[model samples]
Target: MRFPRSSGLLLHPTALPSPWGVGDLGPSAYQFVDFLAAAGQSLWQILPLGPTGYGDSPYQCFSAFAGNPGLISLDHLIQRGLLSYDEVVEASRRYDLNADQVHYGEVLAFKLPLLRHCYERLREGGAPDMAVAFTQFCRDQRAWLDDYALFMTLKEAHDGRSWHDWEAELRTRDPKALAEARTQYAEAFTLQQFFQFLFFQQWLPLKAYANEHQIRIIGDAPIFVAYDSADVWANPELFFLDAEGKPTVVAGVPPDYFSATGQLWGNPLYNWQRMAEDGYAWWIKRLRAAFTQMDILRLDHFRGFAAYWEVPAGEETAINGRWVKGPGAALFKRLEEEFGALPIIAEDLGLITPDVIALRDQFDLPGMKVLQFAFGGGSSNVYLPHHHVPNCVIYSGTHDNNTTVGWFEDLTEEEREVIRGYLGRSGSDIAWDFLRLAMMSVADMAVVPLQDVLRLDARARINTPGRLGGNWGWRFRDDVLNAGLAHGLHFFTEMYGRLPPQPEPDEPAEDATTEDELIYDPVDLATTA
Candidate 1:
């Protein structure tokens, strides 16, 4: 699907400032949307909103279909009578004041119990409408939700061990064992289900607000599922798992520039042939569920659909991986047949082959171009602004990349010289320079990370590949949003013609000088890690 000539900010909700440590769908979210509208943005691109697991990465989620209940707003719960204002105020006191990064363990401990309290209060309130809506949501999503809730409940029961390590009866999903578990932990299972219901409830209203304001939400959908995820445990047959329900081979990449040994992602490889036999029903359902929640979708690791790297089980590194034939065009063909004209943006990065480009273009899906990749090579590099096709989304950098300023600062002198020669500039104000290049590119949509807008250094980096710790925890302070920064962004959006038309008079004005001011320095980048 063709997106309008629009631009947006790339900020995960977790980055938005809040008293609860991590951002949520609270007043801050709505206010952020208002900021977007004021700045003339038509899109609000975010990372996957799934329930994070190990390493607190959204990509490594417990369930692809389930929302992160941690993102549920405690203040909103108070307004709904599920929680009291005093309870929220007391919880806020425990949050770490000095740690800008999310302490997931601490945050989860603080948030989940409160959410549980809310769930119980709502249940006790006996609001028939909410109860009926929750029931309907469960019914509508039973294809995935039931298994996910059960998987989460069971994981808790086993103290968070991988499903393969569970008892043989549960690991193999013996019907009798499952029935017994259902009976034994019915209340816990219901709680898990209720959490997802609340997540969807909160999310729907936010999405509606975006739609009402002429903004659209674009969601990310990673191609591979985590080995320990609910999807794999619930339907082991869909993956290349042995009789013991352990992955015989895993998903990864061959030797790429990012790593000498490549990345052993440790995700279970899908049994494509098995999926094809059922006409890719699992994939169809997954996409359908994603589309229900998001206006547009980005398919991450899109090249995996063309051909994927297979690393044998028990391998410590990706050096022993081999390329295996993926389901390819046949899979997308079936998807289009079922869902019709998917509004997908192909995350066609990393060791892209001719076949990957062919598969991407065949479906007419928009691919991504990162400006950070452009200047390391000559103008002929596909990532260069001049080479960008209209059917692409341009970015200064993605979640996996350092903030553009940090990236430029980290580059070697030789690399900086190459960048200087390519852009015909001294590479001063590197973040804005890259942002300007991306916004002025021929790509249909341009997204600038909020960190780049603030020109933060490596400390504000969202994720680092191959490293496990100290990632996905960055947040902005409320004071970070100021008048000058917003004006500058508005100027760029207006000058580049990426601004969307205002939806209504009462809606925030799209003028550069009228809205709330955001203060940002071209060079005073934050350097904390």
Candidate 2:
């Protein structure tokens, strides 16, 4: 579907500051929504909401369908009488130290125990209406929730070991063993479900509030699933893995700007041939889950859908990888058939090939253009605003790149001079310079990372692709969203005609054909994997 001209902030919920350890779908999230409205933003983009597993990366989640329990608000639990204010207050004190960045370990240590307590309280019949709602939600989401709950319970039972390290019966998902496990870990299973219920329960209202405020949510969905994820464990046949459940081949990009040997993402490669035979059912369900949570979906690694780099499982670097054809238009065609018009943005960054561009254009999905990648060399860079197409979404920087301020600090004189000549601006406030440039670009959408908005340096960097540890932990302070900053954003938004209209009183409208009902195009039709 074609998007209207608009702009927004790319701040993950985890980055939203709260008195609690990590951000949640609590008051802070709602306030963030209000802040977006005040700042004249029509969109609010976030990283995946799935529960992080290894390295606490949102991209490598336990289950694509599950919500991150860590994001549940203890404050809300207190209000519901599931937890005591005093208890949460004490837990808060313990984890309240990280004012600038998320202390994931500390946050998890404090939240998990209290979350388990909340789960126990709910099981004891906390609130009748809420209990009924949770039950129905569990029933509705049973398809993926059943396996995810069992998976989490098992993960806890195995002291957080990968499912492959579990006993053979559970590892191979023997029916008899699973039946016994359900009976044995019945409480654990229920507790996990309770967490999901809490997440969805809280999240739905926040999303509704955004929608009511005339704001649309943009959510991220990684192209590859983590090897140690519940998805891979539950559906082993869908991936390129050995009988022992280790990946025979892995996912990565060959030598690129990010790394000399390229990024060894270490995700298990999908057996696309097998997936295509089944009409990409697993992917459809995954995207279905995503659409339920957000209005628009950004397909991370969009090029991977056309063709992906397959690295040997045992390789330390991605240099030994070979390019393998991906499902491409065939998968998207299936998605369109099942879900109707797709509101998707393609993360068509890196060494994009013609096939990838063709697939994206076929669906008319908006591709990305990052200003950070525009001035490293010359004006020929496609990421430069002059070269960007009107159908694309422009960004000052993305999660993988350093904050624009940090990026400016690291640039050489020649590169800095090139950027200055192009934008015709001084580098004193580099972040805002790029932000203004992106906002004024002809691209239909512009999304600046929250770090750039706050003018934070390396300290607020979200992720550095090849590096390990100390990523995805940055959080804005409570006082960061001051009136001055909001005014600046508002002025630019109005200047560019990107400000969203304020919510008005409800009114009945005339019948109209929605975009989904339009004539379906066969350009995104079935093709070989």
Clash totals for all candidate models: 5, 0
How many clashing residue pairs, candidate 2? 0
Task: Choose the strongest candidate by TM-score.
Answer: 2
Alpha-carbon runs more than 4 Å astray in model 2: 94-97, 501-529
Please give the lDDT score at residue 179 for candidate 2. 93
The residue ranges of model 1 lying beyond 4 angstroms of the native Cα positions read 94-99, 126-128, 501-529
Tens digits of per-residue lDDT for model 1, 1-529: 6778989889999888878878888888988888887777888899999998889999999987889988887777777677888987787688663347777777888888888887787678655656766676677667788899999999999999989889999998899999999999998999998898777777767876786677889899999989898999988999998888889999889886767898888999999999999999888878877887788999999999999999999999999989998999999999899878878999999889999999999989999999888875566898988789999999999999999988888889998998887778888888888878877888999999999989999999999987879999999888877767778888888999898865577877554421111111111111100
List the pairs of residues colliding in candidate 2.
none
Residue-wise C-alpha lDDT for candidate 2, range 1-529, written one tens digit per residue: 6799999999999987787767778888988888888899999999999999768999999988889998987777787788998988777676654766788888888888898888777778887666776676667677788899999999999999999999999999999999999999999998898888788767766787787777899999999988788899999999998978889999988997657888888899899999999899898888877887889999999999999999988999999999999998899999999888899999999889899989999999999999988886666879888898889999999998999999989989888888888878878889999989999999999999988998889888989876788888888878778788889999999998898764356865434433122112111111100
TM-score of each: 0.93, 0.94
